[model samples]
Target: MGRMGDATRTVPCDAVAVSSIIETTGLVMEFPSTRALDGLDLRVSPGVTGLVGANGAGKTTLISLALGLLKPTSGGISVLGLDPSADGPQLRAMIGYGPERNVFPDDMVAYDYVRHFAQIRGLPRDEARSRASDSLYLVGLGEERFRALGTMSTGQRQRVKLAQAIAADPRLIVLDEPTDGLDPVQRDEMLAIIVDVNRKFGIDVMLSSHVLEEVERICDNVIALDAGRLVAQGSLDELAGALGGVDVEIVEVADRRDSIDLVAQRLVAGGWTVARRDPGLTVTGENDEEVFDAVVRAVADSGARIGRLGRRRRTLDDVFTNERGDSSDRPSTARTGGTE
Candidate 1:
């Protein structure tokens, strides 16, 4: 099989115009037992966007609404300038979807499965066959294209799902938990393919995943949801800002504890918040320039050799934790109702 990234064959698909790939206002979805979405507003542009949330945070419901599978309880949504409810068929024709579940038929070969979907998407029989072959090779399944899906591993099955999604050459692709059941190496491969799909084909992508680190790795923008509400939406750099502090690592010394204590005392006197960490200290102040000066003064006053000093970059996890106001180390699993 050809490496996914090495495939130079271009599939036939038109690039979408630059516009709001997805936009929604006051969108809500209510179930019999509870509300899944609550007055959510989102304006996502064309690119790779990460749809992030805890379980039951309306990520799945929102994707359904975008695809026109389910009508909303209130408000409006526009995908590719077409209303999903009014133009469901046309909208779906332009969008490719890879669902989270293993919904493949066990008896079908990979090529036949992808070709079937391509034909269903209105491709001619001959074009469907060609697209299927190219897509399978693009996903590193060229050698396995004739193998039955039931015989494939979980990672290989995921690649098959991706191949079928792109075989029709849709303008946009939406993936849910695409890397759910893969090992570290497999996960990396899948992520590279997703990125290549967008980079090479110009297909806009809305990736829904619970793994924040994976989202941070590839997504250009992030939409973070909490309990069916929009908690945060911005570029990764905008959301994960600098920690507003300097991390200091002190060189080992005979009186290490005493030196750390002295530095802490000096920083506190300088109106800086000092928190002790193993082998280091975290100092934060209102002004970055002043904070830097305070840190240098503290280290010098303590007569301690400085090992390292630098600002720390906040991660998506930190943003999610702070936004949710949940201090638990475990990832968020807050649910509203029904399957997420």
Candidate 2:
């Protein structure tokens, strides 16, 4: 197979032309017994955004509506400045999507599969062939382009899915669980390709995944949903900084419990809100510097040495836990139709 040339490196025109990639207003999708999305209002800027939610949180439903696969029960949605329901064909021509499931023809070779989708997107036969080769190369499957998908490993098959999604040079791509089923190294490689797709091609990306760490790693913004409702949306820094505090760990001593208790008492006396965490305590204050000073004073007064003390930077996992509470036991009522 021929390698991708400079002529085939064209980027989508709409990548820079559009400001908001996706927008929804009062969107609702109801099934027979459960409502998938409830009055969701969202506006996503042009960047790599992570769509986060638990099982049956209407993530799949929202993606379907955005891609014009499913009409909303009520309200409106816009993609690339076009109404998805009204201009689905035109809109889809400018966008690409990779669903969570493995839906591939066993007998089809990688190049043919991607080229077929490129032609379906209206590319000429020659351009489609060039694009298919280029996309496979982009996903690190160039050498395997002629291999039957059935003969490929799970990681290679996933790369083929990604190659097809980008074959037409779409302005935006929606990926659900792009890193699923891959081992650590494969997952890292897939994530790097995703970042390259957005950074190098300027294609906006909306990634939906159960792995918050991967989301945190690759996304510029995040949209969190819960029980079919919009819970949070913002940049990683914004969401993490909202829950700022200090974590203080006491030096382990024969009487470590007593030392921790002493420090906690002193901090509480200093008007700090203290919470017990294993091996130490978490303290919050109106001012961070003041909190740090108080912690120092408390340790000094208690005569307990400090093991570790630092401002706690909250992770995406922490943000999710704090926002969603203990909803782990809540049964999923929303119908995802085989997607999460």
- The C-alpha local distance difference test score for the whole of candidate 1 amounts to 0.85
Q: Model 2 residue 322 lDDT?
A: 72
Candidate 1, position 46, lDDT = 79
TM-score of 2: 0.82
Q: Candidate 1, residues 72-167: lDDT per residue as tens digits?
A: 999999998889998776678788899999888999999999999988776878999999999999999999999999999989999999999999
Q: What is the TM-score of each candidate against the true structure?
A: 0.82, 0.82
Deviation in Å, model 2, residue 233 alpha carbon: 1.5
lDDT of 2: 0.83
Note each model's CA RMSD in angstroms: 7.3, 6.3
Ten-residue segment with the worst summed lDDT in candidate 2?
Answer: 331-340
Best by lDDT: 1
The Cα error of candidate 2 at residue 308, in Å, is 6.1
Candidate 1 residue pairs in backbone clash: none
**lDDT digits (tens) for residues 1-340 of candidate 2:** 2222334334444544766888899999998999999999998888899888887888899999999989999989998999988878778878888888888898999999999999877688999999999999999998999999889888898899898888888889999878778877788899999999999988889988766777878898888888789888888778755465799988856755488899999888878999999989999988988999999998887778899999977876666667768657332222232311
RMSD of 1: 7.3
In candidate 2, which residue pairs get closer than 3 Å at backbone N, Cα or C atoms, i.e. clash? none
> Any runs in candidate 1 off by more than 4 Å, and if so which?
1-18, 248-273, 276-280, 284-310, 328-340
